[model samples]
Target: MDSEVAREQALDAAEKLFYGRGVQAVGMDAVRTASGLSLKRLYQLFPAKEELVVAYLERRDLRWRGRIAEHVERHDDPQERIPAVFDWLEEWFGEADFRGCAWINSYGELGATSERVVAQVRAHKRAFRDYLAGLVTDAGLADVLAGQLFLLAEGAMVTAGITGSAEPAAEAREAARSLSRAN
Candidate 1:
């Protein structure tokens, strides 16, 4: 395979293993095996495990946010768009391999030991919050509503992950609606 394809294959395997199991639990050889790439090529693409972790995070962040944005954009009503965020979350939580927020999971697994992991988590979260803020602004809601919505969404992810239920997304959406009305 070409270098770019090999790189993508490595990341695909790394993301699956890292997110499915704790990052520390999976070894490079596992990624190598999963990707069907040789050890030398894997190392050539990612010099260290930390580099692989970073790449996994970076790709997941972009892909996750893009999916959410696309989902939200499907709705025409501004008010509906806000709730659409939770709607998307609900669908995500229902997936067979649902594993909660990748950033949150990554932080729990490796943030203390890996500053790169810590930075990636923080950056992803900050960007998510900013995205919420944009939605709040576009909806002509109070500025504070942005923070509340962001918290609601994060809380739903954690709750769903812990309890193995997708109901939190709907619950959060109701709360967001109530808060939006109060604003």
Candidate 2:
């Protein structure tokens, strides 16, 4: 196969394996098997397992943010857009394969040992926070409200992941509504 095709296939496999199983638990051999690529081709595409992990994370980050943005964009009201984010989260959390935030899960597994993984996690989080800040600003809310909303969303993700329920997203949405009103 061509380089691009091979690389995408490898990444597809990596995402499934790493996200379904913890990054640390899934090995390169598993990725190669899942991708249907030869060991040598897999290595050529991803020089190391860490490189593959980073690529998986980068791709997931774009898709995850895009999904939330798409859902938020459905709201005509700026204030409503903020809570729409939680609505998207609730939908995602309801997925049968839902395993919580990919970045957070990867960070828990690899952040302490891998600087590259740590960087990816931080970048995803910063981008998310900045997105929330923009939403708050668009709604004529104080900058601090963005931070508060960010914390609420993050906490909800953690709670939902741990409890394996979508209740946290609804709870966070209500809290966000209350905070927006106060602001």
Candidate 3:
């Protein structure tokens, strides 16, 4: 298979197995079997299983942002967009395959063993936080308001993780709307 096509297939399988199964439980062989690629092909695309996880995470970040932007484009108001953002997340949280945020799951799975992966996860998180922070600020919320909304959003992710329910995203959206009244 072509490199891009091969990479995509690998990522698709990784996402399914990683979320449906745990990251640590799924190994390179599992991914190789899932992707229908030869062992050599899998190794060529991903030198290590950790490297594959990082690639999987990078792909998740792209798709996650795309989900947010898809919802946001349907509305002009940033305040409206904030809840819409959570709406998308709510859908994801409800998915049976969604154990939690893949990136976050990977971070916890390989914390001390791999500093490189951990650093990448932190950067992804920082970028996410900053992106939402900017949106809050743009919606005319002060730094304090922005911070509060950010915390609430992060809390929603954790709540979903802990409870395996979509309620947290909806609650977070409602709370974000209330915070919007501040602007």
Ranking by lDDT: 1, 2, 3
Model 2 reaches what TM-score against the true structure?
A: 0.98
Stretches of candidate 2 off by over 4 Å are none
Cα lDDT tens digits, model 3, 53-110, are: 8888887888887777787668787667667778878988898766877667777888
> lDDT, candidate 3, residue 126?
85
The 0-to-1 C-alpha lDDT of every candidate, in the order given, reads: 0.94, 0.94, 0.81
Angstrom error at residue 46, model 1: 0.4
Please identify which of the two predictions, 1 or 3, would achieve the higher lDDT against the true structure. Answer: 1
Which residue runs does candidate 3 get wrong by more than 4 Å? none
Ranking by TM-score: 2, 1, 3
Residue 60 of candidate 1: its Cα lDDT? 94
Q: How high a TM-score does candidate 3 get?
A: 0.91
TM-scores for the candidates: 0.98, 0.98, 0.91
Instruction: State the lDDT of candidate 2 residue by residue for 90-120, as single tens digits.
Output: 9999999888889999999988899999999
